[model samples]
Target: MTLTLTSLGGAGTVTGSRHLLEYEGRRILIDCGLFQGYKALRQRNWAPFPIDPKSIDAIVLTHA
Candidate 1:
């Protein structure tokens, strides 16, 4: 089994926290929160996601 983790957002700053878990050719999104505060952070909200949304198999939001 192969598993890899990718940080879609929320790294250095605090706001949108999203991560992609790829396992066995399946992609799962954890914490689908919105990016808030600061233009840089909020700008991510408008920009296209690093990965394809349709490719994501499931979304598991950790919190509201």
Candidate 2:
């Protein structure tokens, strides 16, 4: 059993808190948020997702 956690966002800043958890051949996304702050940060919102959205097995949002 191999499990890996990847931080898609919210590493340094306080917005766009997204995390990807992969285990047992399953991909789980946590906290799908949007970037909010300076223009540079907000521009990240327009960038494409790191992985294919369809590849995710489930999404677990930590907050609304």
Best candidate (score: lDDT): 2
lDDT of 1 by residue, 1-64 (tens): 9899989888887778899999998999998877888787788898877888899999998877
Candidate 2, superposed: residue stretches over 4 Å from native: none
lDDT of 2 by residue, 1-64 (tens): 9999999999899999999999999999998999999999999999999789999999998789
Weakest 10 consecutive residues of candidate 2 by summed lDDT: 9-18
Residues forming the 10-long window of minimal summed lDDT in candidate 1: 32-41
